[model samples]
Target: MNSSFSIGIPSGRNSSACGYCSPPGERSQGESSYQVAGFDAVQLTCQTYQGMIDRGWRRSGTWCYKPDLRASCCPQYTIRLDALQFKPSKSQRKVLNRWNRYVLEGEPDDAAASSQKSRSGKSSTEFVLPIAVHASEISNLSDESPTHRFEVTLEPSTFTEEKFTLYKKYQSTIHNDHKNSSAGFKRFLVESPLKDEPIPYPQTPPPYLPRQYGSYHQLYRIDGKLMAMAVLDILPTCVSSVYFMYDIDWEDHSLGKLSAMREVSLAREIHEAGVDNMLYLYMGFYIHSCPKMKYKGDYSPSFLADPETYEWFPLESCRPSLDTFRYACFSHPSHSSDEVITDEPDYLQVPLSSDDEKEIRMLVASGKRNFVVSLSESPYWQYDEIQRECLPCIHGLGIDLSKGVIFKI
Candidate 1:
C-alpha cells in the first residue's frame, strides 16, 4: 500500500517522567522512569502505522512513541489476539446474551429508562438478572431471532457533543480522572492521522447499519441509545483498538472484555468477507507489573511483540521471562541481558541502500515534512561512517535531523 501521509523525523534523544511508574518514594530500583523521543505527525498510512505498532510503537492521537522498555521500571509488551480462533468465555457470552435480550424486549418506559440515567445525564439500560432472563427467553427465541441486540456501527471519528459527554462521564466515574477536558478528549480520540480507506467488501449489513471506514468509532447501541464506544484503526491486516469507554452504570456488563471480544468478532467477519490479513485484534500494551493492565493477557491465544527482535511470541511463553525480569526481551533466551539490537550504533553499517537514499531524496525534494522507513537500528553518526554521508543530503533538504522518527528493531 502506498502511503499518502508524511511524518516528521525527531532528532536527538528525549525522555519524560513515566506516567505508570513514577511517584515520590515509591519507585523501584530498576523501574523505567521515562519515555524516549518519538514522532509527532498529523497523519500516517495504515501500513506505516501497522509497522510502527509491530515494532512496539503506539500513538496517542497523532503522537507516535515507544516506551523505553529497557530503562523503565514497568515494561509494557504489545499484545494482540488471533480473532479467527476466538471463543468467548462463559461470562463474555452472558454479557452478549443479556444485551441481545434487552434489544429484543423493546425499550422500557421513559420513567424506568430515565431512572437509569447517570448524574451526567447519560442513559444506561441495566440488565438485572440477565442470566435468569436468558434461560427463560432462550426457549421462545427462534433460530432466526437476532442473538445480538446491540448494533455495532463504524463511522470515521469526529468531534461530537454526545461522544464528549460520554468520555467525560467515563473518565470521572471510572478512573476518577477529574482532569479530563473536551479539548483533551478531542486531541486524544477524535483526531486521527490515518487516512480513510474503507475495505472494498460488499455491504450486506442488516437494514439501518452504517458502513465502516478506516479510523472509526465502533459504537454499541441498544435500541438506538449509545451505551459504549471503541476508538479503532481498521487497517488492511488488523483492527487496532486505540481506546474504550463506557457508561459506568453498566460496569456489571464487563463492557471492556465484551468490547474486545466484539472486535475479534469484527475482525473475523471482515476476513470471512474476503478481506485478506484482517485476522488479528491488537489489544495494545500489556503491563505485567501493573495489575490493572494485566487483564490484557486474559484473552487467550494472544501474542506479545518482542521489544528487541520485533518478532512475536505467545504470551504463555513470554510470561516466564517477565516473571523473572521486569523487562523481557524475547529475542534473547533470558530477559536479563541489557544488550539488544536497538543499542547497536553501527547496526546499519552500509550506506543507506540506493533505493532508500533515492526515496529519501525524493521525499526531501517534495518538501514532505514526514516520511516512513523500516528502521532496524537507530541512525547515529557516531557508529556508522556511512550515516555521515547522508547527513549532507538531509541537511541540504532542510530536514531537521534532531527531531525525526527512528524505530529500533
Candidate 2:
C-alpha cells in the first residue's frame, strides 16, 4: 500500500458540477502539508492547491480527501473496492471485450451496438495492463508475509486529434430509438440556460486547461482511435463525475460502466494506502421521474443528498420522498443531523373540465364523494418513477402536487 497522492479542490463550471465528467492536471505549490503514517504531504495549501500528482480523480463508494471547498459544491468522491473482491457484471464484461476487440482488430465496427445484444455470455481475453499507480508511495499490505508483488507505471493512453473528430461523427450515429435519447439532453446543456437568457458555453471545445483548473482527461483508444474519454477533477474530499461520452457504436461495449469500474478500483487502492475518509461516487442528481436517470440508483450502498439537510440519506430511506415533483435535501453522516427539508413549487393536480366538475358534484350528492390528492400528499409517490412511467399522461393539469386540490362548486 502506498500513501502517495495529492489533494486539492477544483472550481468553476466544470463537468464535476453537473455529473458529466471531472477536472484534469496536476500542479504543486508551497502550502501546508498534512502528514499521516506511511505518507507525508509535500504541498498542502489551505488557500491554494497545486500538486504534481496527475492521476485522474476516481469516483466510487469512498474518497480519501473529499475537499471542503464551497466553489466545488460537488467534489469528486472515490469508490474504494477490494479489487480482488470485484466480480464484473455481464454488461461490464461485454464492454471490456469491446475495447479489447477494438484493440485486436482495426476500426470499422461502428455499427456494433445494434448487434451487441447477441454478443453476450462469453468471456473475452482478459485485459492485463501494468498497474499504473500515480500516488507517491506503494508498500506491502501485510506485515510478516511474503513480499506482495506489483508493477507501477503510467497507464498507457491513446488520445489523439483524429479520435476527437471520430467522436463528433459518431455522436449522431446511433439507433433512432436512442437517437433522441441523451442527445436531447446534450442539446439542452449546450442550448438551455438557468434563465431565458443563455450564457455562452465554450463555442469550441476549450483547450485542455489542466493547470488552470487542476483536472485530468483520459481518452481510451482502440487502434489509435479514441473510443471514450473521461475528464476528472481531484477534489479534497470526493471525485465528482463531470461528463462521460462514448462512441454510440461502442455502447454495447459498456464503456461507460467500465470507466466507472476503473475509477472505483483506483479509489479503493488509494483509500487502502491511507486516504481514509474518501468514499462515494457523487452521481449528480437523480431525477426519479427521468427513466434515463434511474440507472444511477443501481449503485449499491448509495445515498441521495437530502435537499433540506445537505446530508446524504440512504436511497432506501429516501425512496418515498423522490415521488413528488419537489423535494428538500436531507442529512448524511457526512452532513449535519439537524438539517430540515423545505418544500419547492410542485405540480400535483388532475385537470377538471366544467362537465367533470358537475359530475363530481353529482357524485358527491350521490354519496360517491370525489377527492383529489396531490402526489406529495400521498407520501408514497416517487417523482422520478412517476415521471418515467407516467409523464405527459399527467401533464397539462395545473397540478400543484405540493398544494391543496381545488374542489369544483
Candidate 3:
C-alpha cells in the first residue's frame, strides 16, 4: 500500500508492425501485432511480478504487457519450460560442451564434443546440470587452467560504455539498425524497476552465483573481451529471460539458444538449492505461427498459458490446435475459433493504513492512483464491437494483479 510493493499504470491496447513475416516499408491489410492493456510499472516485487507473468504478462524494462492472441497476425502465447524436467538434446549438449571445452581447454572441440555424448560428458557421470552449465566459468574451475579465461558476471542492470558498444555492434550487425542510440538501448535493456530480493538459497551461494531476485545483465567475456550479454529477471519462481545479444562474430556458436539453456540451469540451481517453487524458465511469448519463434517449443515438457483461462497446457498437446488456427485455445480445443473477450473495469484502491488513507483521500481523491483506464469506458465498447482486438488484459492478468496495481494513465 505504501509504494514499496508494486505500482503500475495501465496502457491501453496498442498495435505495432509485426516482427515476423512483415516486410519493411509495406502495409498489408489485417497484418499488425497487438497487445492488450499494459502496465507501465514504476516498481514491483519479485513475487508480485512472478504472479503477473504466470497470468500471461511479460515485461520489457518497466513496461509489462500481454499479447492479444485473437487478433494479432502472430498470436503470442506465454510459454515456460519446466527446468527440472528438461533434457538437453544432442545438439544442445554439444553447444554447451563445446563452449565449456573451449573455455577450460582453450580450443574448440567440435569433433570431440560430438563423440562424447554420454550423460553430460563432464567429470561426473551423475549429469548435474547446474555444475555442467557453470563448468566453464572461472568460479567453478580448479587450479588446472586453460589458455582463455571465460568469465560470466552477474550484476544489476546499468549502463556502461563497453555494454553500449556491444549493443551498438549487435544492433548494426544483426538488426541492421546502425543508428541505435545509447538512450534507446538504455530504455530497452538497461532500465528496470525490479527491486533485488535475495534468492531463498538454503545455503548462501558462491559469490559468482546470483544471490538476488531482480533484473540483471549476465555478461559473457572470453579472455577479458566482452562477447555476449543476456538481460534477465531473476524472480522468486523463474528466471524470466528479457533479451539476449551476442557479437555477430560468435553467431555460429548459437549463443541465443545457449543463453536459454544457461537460464534453465540457473533456475535448476536455485531449485536444487532448496527453493521448491523455482522450477520454471519463463521464455517470453511463443508465437507458433512464426517459424523463427516456434523453436521455443523444442524445449520439451514445456507449457503454453491459455489466453482466456490462464491455465497451463503441455506444448505438444496444444500444437494440433495451434496448427489449425492462429489463435488456438488448447483448454477447449473444440472452441478453436478466434474470439475477443471483454473484461470489466480493473481498478481498486491499494489498501492503506486507515489514518493515512483518510488523509490522502482528503488531499486528492485520486491520490497516487488515477490513470488506469477501464475497458468499459471506451465509446466503442458501448456499441458492442470486438474486431481487430485481442482479449482484454484484465482477463489475461486476472483481478488480483488488476486491483493490486496502481492505475497509471
Highest lDDT model number: 3
Candidate ranking under TM-score, highest first, comes to 3, 1, 2
Best by TM-score: 3
Q: For residue 308, what is the lDDT in candidate 1?
A: 74
Tens digits of lDDT, candidate 3, 1-409: 4544566555456655577744521222455555456667787878778988887788887887776666566778899999999998867776787777777666655565545644454534655667678877876678867677888888999999999999999999999988888899999999887878878778877566688889999999988999999999988888899999999988877898789899999888778778888899998999776778888988867999987788999998898888776668877777676443323323321222334222211111265553333434322322222311212444445556545454433
Query: By summed lDDT, which 10 consecutive residues of candidate 1 come out lowest?
Result: 400-409
Which regions of candidate 2 fall more than 4 Å away from where they truly are?
Answer: 1-160, 174-213, 328-409
Q: Compared to the true structure, candidate 2 yields what TM-score?
A: 0.40
* Candidate 1 TM-score over all chains jointly: 0.72
Per-residue C-alpha lDDT of model 2 across residues 1-409, encoded as one tens digit per residue: 1112122111111222223212211110111121110111222221122111111122221111222111222222222222333455555554554554443333335656425524663343343311312111123123322122221212212344554454455555642232433344333222211111111223332222111112344555543446666644433333445456667766766666767665555444434444554344444445453445666665555665443223455666666544422222234323322222112213224433434323221101225654333333332234454332222212211123101112111
Better of 2 and 3 by lDDT: 3
RMSD of each: 9.1, 22.4, 6.2
What root-mean-square deviation over C-alphas does model 3 reach? 6.2
- Model 1 has an lDDT value of 0.63
